[model samples]
Target: MSKRKKAPSGNPANRGLSFVDRRIARDFERWLAASDTPLSDPHNAAGAVGHLFDITKRSGLDILEPSDTADIADMLLDIGPNATGMVDLFHDYVHFRLETSRDPRWHQAHDELEDVLDDDTGISAMLEAIITDAETRDPAVIADALAHTKVIDGVTKLLDWISTSRPITDTGALRLSDIEPAAAALGLRAAGARTLPATGDLHGQTAIADGITYVQSMWHLEPLAAWWRALLDTDVLELTASRVRPGRASQRWRTEPTPPLDVASEVVALVVSDTVLGDLPRPLRLGCFTLPGARHTCARGPHPRRRRQARTPHRDRRTIRPPCRTRLADARRSRPGRTDPQPPRHPIRRSRGLARRLCYRPARGPR
Candidate 1:
């Protein structure tokens, strides 16, 4: 039998990227240079935005923090339609141009190069450049510059796409096909955005963008939990909450190890809600309630009455007896002079009686 040849590990730094990959990277670099966004340095802006996208996607929320929402809303309002075009164009280049290139391996090489450019070393120069620019720029210069630019509006739309339960289409935009995947991922019933009319008092382009914005915002703000609570104190999100695992859309359950039974009992699965989950510690934020069967897990803490009962301990004669003691007490009641112990029907109960004789037998004075 011949051993199969292993594929070589590809790296841009060691092996050097293909000419096509380098060209694509340079194109991306030029795009970043031409932009004037909130974060003057494109690397930092991309990093921050990418982090926000991931968190938003995982938690299924539009606004992670309420205080930041106003600032974000204002930023988006400032970044007009032109900025939105820039974003769409960039996504087109990344998703389509590289993938459709003549060289079969060009797509894989381009993806690898992009990943490297996102690293700390790749971004270090950009960070230093920001510092140099800051000497002449105003205090909190990035935030100030961003506040004035229309960049946020476009970026927010991109984020809206990322945060949605929908999967990104081949074109990097959400499609109707993505609805089911999105629903499964975020535990939301996905719906298509309402179609916009052809023309309006505003330019057709502006009107369409505004309509998209409105529809996306409307569905995102209204969580299933909030909708349910409005109708009743409790509501069912799904029938199989226990069987539902993390990364459902991605089929992560098939590979990821199921937590032990004891650990599973302690696990608290995260739900999609309006509340800020980003504020939680990482572990707890990801934990989902493993409610077996058709049970609906309560979000609220323990009941006040239960808390009081737990704190106060009392012994009840009928219920509190140990197996051995209960058997002895029964035997004493049943016959006047019978002191011999009766063997318990079950092996476990019999073992307990034998253990009782060993531990608590009347002490035969120094015997």
Candidate 2:
């Protein structure tokens, strides 16, 4: 994970939760910028007074955190006809423009995504499709993918340990001697070979390949223990009480080296993602961005309204270490009443996870 560059602009304590705040704040701005709603118009100014106040109240509500899938769906549905548009802006801002500045590291994983945002004006359709699926998606899908990832992680470690000792018994089954150390690696508990029941409901479900049973490892027992049992139940090891290595997928997984945590997380997310969702490869990736707490100019921390109001191009003010740009826009040409040339009104139609894409302007010479 990227280290917090300069201590997030929010409370140090609040940094943990600031990912949601920062994401919501920027989402709100991007939505307003891309929508048909003309924030720059004088007539809309009459309504802006009430919506801005509502934005303040809503932001104070910790962004109306949804408890379940239904709550999010309701919030988004209401935004469509509520007429004020603040609810919609705040409620669903997944379609957003990417900032001009980005860390080089993220480019490796998201290079194609960045290209899509920068060049694909059609991204708005994709963004809408994502939202449709996201509303129906379990908000905790990321957590679920991580849980699966742990299994992959724990199992890989256990298998490596097994290879060194070859803990196989005379009967050709392996023993669980010294298994606790493997379990400890994953922060999970292991048994003394006789702790768990000899057979689970799928006692005979082992996959026998070339006379060697290859048991399938599905969701069970944290991550490590379930995998340990896969080996034991398949007779790779003597089926003892405590088993289940977290990372290994099945008997075949042993033949191949385990993927890096990032790769593993992405693969697992894809396995769980629906086509409509486009892709689920990056809860861990997004976490990588937010977990470190994105840096912004305001040291007191980022507020959605404050985030929205800061429209000027900050130049070098909040250039995050490793290059995470905090400025939502390069507002030099975006400020009102300036008769300078402007990019398309809604240059890059995007939002929330849709962060990426700004006006593709030519390189400028230093003024």
TM-score of each: 0.18, 0.21
Give the clash total for candidate 1.
12
Q: Where in model 1 is the C-alpha error above 4 Å?
A: 1-177, 184-189, 194-252, 255-268, 272-298, 301-367
- Estimate the TM-score for candidate 2: 0.21
Model 2 residue runs over 4 Å out of place are 1-40, 61-153, 157-185, 188-252, 260-262, 265-367
**Prediction 1 global C-alpha lDDT:** 0.29
TM-score of model 1 vs. true structure: 0.18
